[model samples]
Target: MELPIDHFRLLGVSPATDGQTVLRTLQQRLDRAPDQGFTHETLQARADLLRNSADLLSDDRHRTAYEAELTALSAEGEGGQSAIPALEIPNSKEVGGLLLLLEAGQAQEAFEKASRGLQPPQAPALGSSREADLALLAGLACQGAAEDYRQQRRYEAAARVLQQGLQLLQRMGQQPEQRRRLDLALEALLPYRVLDLLSRDLSASLERNEGLQLLEQLVRRRGGLEGESDAAFPASEFQPFFKQIRQFLTAQEQVDLFSRWAEAGSPLADFLASIALTASGFAQRKPERLQAAYGRLAGSGQAGVEPFLACQLLLLGQIEPAQALFEQGADPALRQWANEQGEEPLAGLCAYCRDWLEREVLPGFRDIEADPDLEAWFADRDVQAYVEQQDRKRARSAPLHPPEAAAGAGAGTPSTQSSLDAMPLWPGDPLASGLAAPSQPGQSGALSEPLQPEEDEDDWPDLALGWPNLHWQDLQLAERWAQLRTSAAELLAQPPSWVLPLAVAVTLGGVGVGGWLALRPKPERGQPIPVLPAPDGTVQTGAKPSPAATGAPKAAASPGAGAPGAPAPTPAPPAPRNLPLTVAKPSSAQLRSLLEAWLAAKAAVLAGATPEHPLEQLARSALVGNVESQRRENASRGESETVTAEVRDFSVTSQTPQRIEAEVTLRYSDARKDANGKLIASTPEGERRNTYVFARDGQTWHLAAFRASR
Candidate 1:
């Protein structure tokens, strides 16, 4: 007979047993599986189950209670009494329709319909067929329901249903499909569960107390059995799911997991060993362990070879090698060349390395290179000096760095400076002149190699990347930006008032033509506008109306209409007059106040300290400043800044809530110098651009963009 479904029984133990005992027993079973007629599927499945169950038992409460109960059961009876639970296999045809219907997302309805229309069972009297099928159907139905719930983001309900389904599937050992379905359901549910817990638990975990403890517990519980596969089920079908689990492991505190898996020589032992070694090296900052971990990956011949190779180079701190591999592997030559020219090539490699180190290596390490404790472990004085010098040099030359590179008293000392300037191609060479041994015959090329290029940011070294120095490119870019700035200033010098009205008329003409076609009547029923009405007294339809008949109103006879009922035409109404505007000229005191307000606004935007939204505050303050400055100028005060006293000939044509139009003339004398009080240029040379604008809010106006006159 097949083994019972109870994990304890399968392991030849009672429920009261501890995880350690259970684990040992399971290992022994795995070791002898080949000789015991266990298929690969069965063996792997059982191993996964054992590993997962042992992990579950690691909790203090669970372990304690489970062991106590198992011990009591052991004391009660032996052999047949404590049988491992056997899974009931459902007949293929029996649950076939149910499975398909459940797959279609109609599980509950399908189950109810099948139950109500059940046919009498043809099974033996040993067990009730109706009961067995119902149990099986109920389990499948719950899993299907859970999937629906998960899709709708009802995660808590999904988790509950999934947990129940998994339990039921465990009892339905006879049905492989049921087992498979349950595994898939759990795989899908686990990610959402982990994410939800993380959102709530991340802050607590950051704290030093029980906060991190709770997060760790939730991570283990949610992410632990993620990669476990059902033996009776096809695990390969869920490769993407397994990949996701592996990703989650990188983000959590997984040392305990790695150690346990390594000790057990589990199928994941290779990966775990790598994580363990790399983590230790990273935490300790020991390069050897880091190198060793990478070496292990090289031997694996796995598909994720890029990450492994990258890890080794990164740990060794050989950026160029890793960069070469990444470029060659991830892109075409043209794209790769372009990428190299940009910052992305090196940056991408570095980001990838950082992420891997963060995940698999010492999850706790921060600033791995500078950690003094790690540095002290390397006993070689020369290597230490070499590494330190290289780091300092790198810190100096690294692009886009903050001012930290230029700080520190000995930051640019000769010893450190040379290492930072080492040629990328000469990675193995010491920064100091440690010459190579004399070359043999036919090795003259090596001996005659030219001295390295001068250590200047603009100069190229022997390496290909260093050859096309980025400094020249940056200088070119700066020059282009300067030219653009000058062009923009010239453009802004021209006034907008003259350009806007003509552009508006042109735009309106186009709109009018388009509107005419849409608004005018179209020829319908093969009838078109005729030149005149027919000769008869009757007016023919479809004729264009004459000017007099086009709503112009008929003229009256000499004095008045002869008809007694006729009334004189009402006098035509006159068009409304536009409101006049008032303009102000700014003086020194007003100018100072306006500039002060504007400067404050600008400073606030930069500091992010402004009470109002930065841009809104900027616009409002600018308007106030402009209005105040206009007022000051109109008062004929002394020339201020670039603005001077002029013949304040200004006029306002219109002033409505939605529209404003104005004209002004401005002139100024030489203003005072800058804060240093030097002699300033004469003539008020600043240009003033006038604009008529439609306003949304009565107090604020946004300039509708218009083209400049050619």
Candidate 2:
């Protein structure tokens, strides 16, 4: 048979060519091929190469398997024996078998084979390079096994396998390359280890110390705190673990460790030292060290570091310097830190700084103007003359009654009035003719002058109509008689014949009646007025009876009832009804209390306190249903964790007789540790707002439902 062409060579690409390169090469070959006439064998070869190239380059698993198969085939074709003999280490056959098993995805078999390989005794004088290769193979096997465990969420098992592999490599004194690979593997595995430990009951003991040491090793392998290695672990990925470890150490121990690390010039050492110093109260006693630590952080030129340093400075009572720093730095982190510190002025200053930098500095730089001396330019005679000419032109071009004329009219001379002949007038106005007439010179002058009041004549008003003191009553009577005579004469002139007779008769009748009434005797004294009986058999009197005599009900006798004969007995006032009970909305004090109670309960649960513990009781009193049940379950599990919630503010959005709705902002933190007292995980401190529905159980408000939001 003709020698089979390698797919890579046929495709005109290297064996290591990527999928895209392979596809591109295949496309080129297809495009160049003839449309018709080709041999069957050639077509078959092309198809085979295309398929094999795609398979080898597309998927990692497939590629790895193919490569291994190719290696095995090459070895077999060369001879019945391999070119490179396996090293004489613990169970070398098992080591080879483990590699084969791992490549085939037989992880269980691989783990069993690796375990068997690790069981044998080591040779006394293995070469260093050979030993390192063996150790490297063993680590790969263990890593495969650990990955298998991890896929099943068996974290503890994974950690155990990794730990065993690390120990083996350490004993063998792994080569630099081998050690780097193993360190990377361990770095990936550390988080799982921490979680496993925290989930178990081995936190406060030697296992915690071991785990911490493992973390330190990983940290050191990544170029220690200075972060000098390109392969250094990401701070974001490992910062929580570092914080956790520090949480387990006392302030003094932390200070000692931080001091040592700082002396060694670790990058994060200053930050750690600051925390330790603050916790140990050394910030107040030996502020110089604090200052040095902050100085180092500030010098790092890292984002957000300045804000923290400024906050610390402010706390230490260095107000002026802190203020200056806040006004200078434009970091958003500063605002957050200031808010957390409850320094409103500092926060405001940081906000101002951010605004200034964004709105003024950035835009000003983008649109900068040349700085010309405006005052000096204006002082030049030509420029001044030009400006004056423009002003005069504008003034002259303006209307006689400019818009500003009304405002400044009183400040200058009055404008001359236009002649009435030249002004428009409405038709039929009474003053139209008067205004239209041409004025005489004297008349115009007289019209312009203000009028003067006429002088009063006291002599004429003193006696013209004044009456003398001589018999004023008699004079009045005589005047009345004269008026009566005049009236009588006028009446007689128009009177009919009956008028005089009727008048004489009326006069005589009046005289006769007066004489008769004068002669009649007047009835005197003490006669009784009669009372009539009505059809209803009640006595009726013309005058109304007094309230006391009649025994009638008074208006004030009964509330909202009217007295008899009162105007329509004003409709009785509407019946008094109780208003809907207004359940008092939860106040900040109440929300804060609830927050404290909840935090206390969560802390108790994390501390592994029994359900009957006082803290649990307090928690139960504050919480209900699922929340309470969850606490109990956590407590039963003996979880070593603590949570604290601080309520910053709350608003009651709605309320009813039985329930209330409120939005609460709380800063929350949850810390977890292993049974050996080594912290493994903790939530970063942050503010969260939750809408809570509180149900009223009797008089106390209990949390019913809550939705956490941004």
- TM-score leader: 2
Q: State the lDDT of candidate 2 residue by residue for 214-320, as single tens digits.
A: 54565566665545363444655454455444434445545565566656666455455554554333212444444444554555344433444554453333344
Give model 1's TM-score versus the native structure: 0.23
TM-score of each candidate structure, all chains considered together:
0.23, 0.27
Q: How many angstroms is residue 58 displaced in model 1 relative to the true structure, after the best TM-score fit?
A: 57
lDDT of 2 at 220: 61
Give the winner by lDDT.
2
